[model samples]
Target: MPVTELTTDAEALTMTLIADVDAPVERLWRAFTDPRQLERFWGPPGWPATFTEFDFTVGGRARYHMTSPKGELSRGAWEFVRIDEPQSFEVLDTFVEADGTVFEGFPAMRMAYSFEPTETGSRLRNVTYFASHEALEQAVEMGAVEGSQLAMGQLDAVLHDLREYAQGKGTRTELLDDQHVRITRLIDGPQELVWRAHTEPALLEKWMLGPDGWRMSACEVDAVAGGRYRYAWEPLDPAAGTAFGFDGEVVLIEPIRRMVTTEHMTDTDYPSTLNDLSLYEEDGATLVTLLVEYPDRETRDAVLATGMTDGMEASYARLEGVLVSLPG
Candidate 1:
């Protein structure tokens, strides 16, 4: 029944972070407000973000440009709370969990960022608020303290360069330049055997889909461009879970050489993804690449946001099984 009044100097540790940065005021402002710039220092090192719908203004939203191990880019929104230009700004950040459930308890923390003019450069402070003491303590136990420290360190490095670079900049820069999901695998067997298991309907059903509740209801291909391939994936428990899965569009088909197809994605009347499969040969092993492109970053994020490095490693293990199951 009561509205929580906004506050400054929200603390995440014993001592709140002092807003002291080695850059000028304008550069510090850019770091927080610019999605691409924030991305450079947002996540820990080597974690680059691919932002979408990045409008960092009041009542606007922004998403972190992040990709899961399986080439899925997880995205979240930043509801702008306030913006005070070169001095302070606030946002309520939201993130996705692994199990595809959305939980927002104590999540609407007030982020108060400040940039003060320092004799040398600028002083910056980012104070984060938790709804309660218990929330803060729980976050601390979850390594939030250490993670914030690492992120601040990266922010320092990015701001240091931004001040100098801003003086000679041309136009707005985009972070997502020349980015694509890359898939690579090696399938052992003769070129034809490998090709057969990939294009031929019968062999594909042997080891492709997991046996949980999946079956190849229909598998047909024209084996030529201007031609197409169709696969019917009927879930055993349609009443219990999602419905049928079908999608395979022939983009390119060269017998004994290569086949490129866009996997038609359908999940309970919702559009899914487009997977491109390419097969080649090198060093006596057939090289197969499965590149999946999603309709939007969110869909990709749904599958990958969980940091699927281990699962992906295991999926490749299953792919190895798929190759072994092929007829030699």
Candidate 2:
């Protein structure tokens, strides 16, 4: 299991974002500041955006409505607390009814947004705050996990347009798109065959669609937590891209059921995080769920959306194809 360790905050707001837009912080700022621009591309697709009033300034309020394709309307307002032109802004946010009535169950939230110019592109962070731990927990349980993911999906699309609009190289890590692509395929094969395809390099090489030229340079396994293993893959083509893939620890592994491993691109066996992948045999097929909980949402999503899921799905589909070819 391979995963990039991103940020997981202690405060429990669970608010995360990854915006790799074409424009520098300035352009991203303008897009955020310009109410018209914000309205042009806000909410998920097929969702219409309408504003009652938007004043981008300290002490000012941004009242707006979002109408979903399914005819659902969720309005909200944000009262600005801090303002740093083209750089940062803080506001209190919440949802409300069409008649300007805030919901009772959901509490008002504080959000601090930051924009920075990155050598690769631009990074925008939203530090959202809730009233209490319980509130955050409730939000998480009430579809926040799925909601945040869908929001990022919209951000991905918006930034794609912004990159082109601003004539910048959008955040694209291979054909995968973004980091969080879900690998969903019902693989019908024997437990032994499925296990071999994952652990054996010779079998894996034929299945894995790593970056072009990626070959399992070295493969080792202990299959348990507190155990260690190292894997190195060489790029079949040196000139095409960077070569040298290494992760030297096996933090957790459960034979035939699950495996959790720490992966690092560097060879230092450096400080890193963990990735858990579980497999269950259901209806004579393997149901595999890979959850790479990163320390932060930024880098985590970078790998999630990248054809990682697509790549995995394709590989597993091929693996199943190969399995069918095997003699019964």
**Candidate 1 TM-score over all chains jointly:** 0.42
lDDT of 1 at 13: 30
Model 2: lDDT of residue 68: 47
Cα shift from native, residue 185, model 2 (Å): 28
Model 2 spans with C-alpha error above 4 angstroms: 1-14, 156-328
Candidate 1's C-alpha runs over 4 A off are 1-15, 65-75, 97-106, 160-328
Candidate 2, TM-score vs. the true structure? 0.46
lDDT (10s digit) by residue, model 1, range 171-284: 221122122343444555556777777677767676555445556677777777656777666677777555455665666555775455665545445554555454545445
Q: Which residue pairs in candidate 1 have backbone atoms (N, alpha carbon, C) closer than 3 angstroms, thus clashing?
A: 19-123, 19-124, 19-125, 20-123, 20-124, 49-65, 50-65, 247-264
lDDT of each: 0.57, 0.60
